[model samples]
Target: MPGKHVRFSRNTHFQSPPTPALSFSSISPASSYAPLTPPVIPNNYLPGPSPYTIGYAPIPKAPTIRVHPVLEYSSHQNVDFDILNHPSSITKNRRLLSSLVLSEPATSTPLRSMVITCPHLPWIITVYPQSGSHITVYDVFYEIYRSLHKSITSSDFASLPSDSARRASTRAYEQRYSRHRSSRHRDEEKRSGMLRIDFLMGMTRFAGLSPTGRGPDVWQLNIR
Candidate 1:
């Protein structure tokens, strides 16, 4: 058996298999893959001021503070000599007297008005001020005691209406005077004199004297 011969044309060519177009149903879901994100950068990477920001912020101001003036003794420019001298005037103006005494400087001199002759006694008690010398509660007290003692010991004090009244007055005066002689006394005697002065001035109890505590000599007057 003879086979038939097959011949191909010069223009005849063989082609590769055509690629198929991808369909939506055939594609995988985007959730299956990880999401894309920007890279992380450190704070020190920029090494300069931010472009969005301006100059440095203003500094806050400090709060204002008010300081009060300290209370101190004043010079006796407005003191009335007549009122300061008279016992009756002192009795009438106990509060005013207290204020005046409290404001007096410790180194202040005894005014001439402080000198007085005892009405009930024959003695004249005087406080003489010396240059550059300071006075203390003790000195004032001593003068007051002398004046009070002279009065209490006089015939006039003994001639009070009732004997009981006279005895009470004597006992009171002695009790006050005896405190100075006590061993435990500090400035107690002076305090007693202050009380006596207040009583004589007709005040039930006036403000008391206080030590400045800065020194043994420094004293402050307290007014209530």
Candidate 2:
């Protein structure tokens, strides 16, 4: 311990042994030299955009509404349109309308339902036979009308199956109803509007008040 020594001098640098005293390999300039470099990436910059196109996936448009061929299939007697098709009159079955002249077929099943709404109007009709019960027979009329109304209000008649006879029938039914519906709305407004005025006057009378005079006892016209 007395002979052991260490030195620090401004003029001389301390050197490591040629290789670490514990290892056999010789030290070389390549092994000893290292540069104090900063890290590979700094925090400020963001990653660049990807090579793949930056955009929304092109939205595929919905396929154009397709209308199928207006097909007339005399439904099997026992199924689908059975109860609705068969009514009490055997002679009045579709054979009557089927026998009518200047008739043609339509392209769609729904369109076929449009034909036979009016008795007076010219039509190439296909009849829906009715059930035996009185209640059901009456209901057939209502159901037919409801079906027609729904068909008219629904999207487009272009999709209806094409049949010359069927189309003509549908046209007649639609034409008759168009006139009827227009007049019906006009009549309703006339009736309801007058009834509303009558109701207001009745209320005023019951309350023992007149609209012309003022006060809590007098009726006030609340024109909304």
What lDDT does model 2 reach?
0.25
Tell me the tens digit of each residue's lDDT in model 2 across 56-139.
555454222111111111222211221112222212224422211102221111121222222111222232323221111122
Looking at model 1, residue 210 earns an lDDT score of: 39
Tens digit per residue, CA lDDT, model 1, 54-91 = 55544553322111111122342222222112222333
Candidate 1 global lDDT: 0.32
* Estimated TM-score for each candidate: 0.25, 0.18
Off by over 4 Å in 2: 1-135, 151-155, 162-174, 177-224
Model 2 poorest 10 in a row by lDDT: 201-210
Which residue ranges in model 1 land beyond 4 Å of their true spot? 1-113, 116-125, 130-142, 149-154, 173-224
